[model samples]
Target: MFTKILVALDRSPMGKQVFEQALALAKATGASLMLLHVLSAEEEGSPYAPLLTNFDYYPGVGSQSFEHYQKQWDNFKNEGIQLLQSLSAQANTAGVNAEFTQQLGSPGRLICQLATTWGADLIIMGRRGRSGLKELFLGSVSNYVLHHAPCSVHVISVPSQVTQAEEAPQETASVN
Candidate 1:
């Protein structure tokens, strides 16, 4: 009974699973999809800071380090846009109406805000399965959304094994 579905996505592999599940649900229920990507420094793999050793102060805007960091941030934002576009295209090709947006902010708050503003009937997102001390320190976006969202929230838990596999470095095969 969902008319509008909001799908929160990230760069992680689990994000694709979340989108696929949301797309299927939208197709089944004839619901429009809103694909959202929130850019935050807290996000895993974010290039929000430069790798400076023993740095005491923020890099000046005119400094080379700052310029390099800025370029990395810009590239990150562009990648997020490209991701959303690809997902939206996939949804459209599947005969589901879809729109996408990328915003820079706290993920949990932005997700709930968008859901409320868009009047989404449901929110579909992925959980990294963080727990205990890790969850306490890092904060879980799905957990926050589940408690604070204006609409029903469906959380897809990303298996720990899958996460580990994704993080592991790929080995190159030697051609004999």
Candidate 2:
């Protein structure tokens, strides 16, 4: 029933899965799909902020919070743009009308905002993301989107890597 769909993705397998799923849905509905990725200031860097708060997590956590995350944030933005491009190509090959947007900000907040700005009818995303336990404590982007999405939101739970690993043994046994 959806005509406009938005999918958020990063450089993770789960993100890939989410995009694939969205593309399939778009194809079935003859809908348009948007691939959006947002880079957090903390994940990228706030070089333009009036005042810089040092970031010292990964390498420079001891600095202030801004210095350390700037480079990382930049990398995240650039990498995410590349990924969105690749996803757009795949969607095109699938004969699905797809466009992409790479923005900067908090992932959850930005995702929800795009849904409104793009007038998306539906949002499809992974329930658990790459953030791991930190996401659990901070609440996941999916969680936030689920609660705040304008129209409708579908939070699909992707099977974890650990489960895929464990399933290998079962897969081979089942094959024989």
Winner by TM-score? 1
The digit string of per-residue lDDT tens for model 2 on 1-176 reads 89999998766666778987898899999989999877654332334343344333346345545655567657666777888988899899999889999886788899989999999999988765435566656667777788888988877776677555644464533554
lDDT of each: 0.90, 0.76
Model 1 segments beyond 4 Å from truth?
Answer: 50-62, 163-176
The local distance difference test score of model 1 is 0.90
TM-score to true structure, per model: 0.85, 0.71
Candidate 1: deviation at residue 122, Å?
Answer: 0.1
What is the model-wide C-alpha lDDT for candidate 2?
A: 0.76
Residue-level error in angstroms, candidate 2, position 77: 1.9
Candidate 1 lDDT, 1-176, residue by residue in tens: 99999999999888989999999999999999999999998777789874444343545434676668778889999999999999999999999999999998899999999999999999999998776787899998998999999999999997787766666687789998
The 10 consecutive residues of candidate 2 with the worst lDDT sum are 42-51
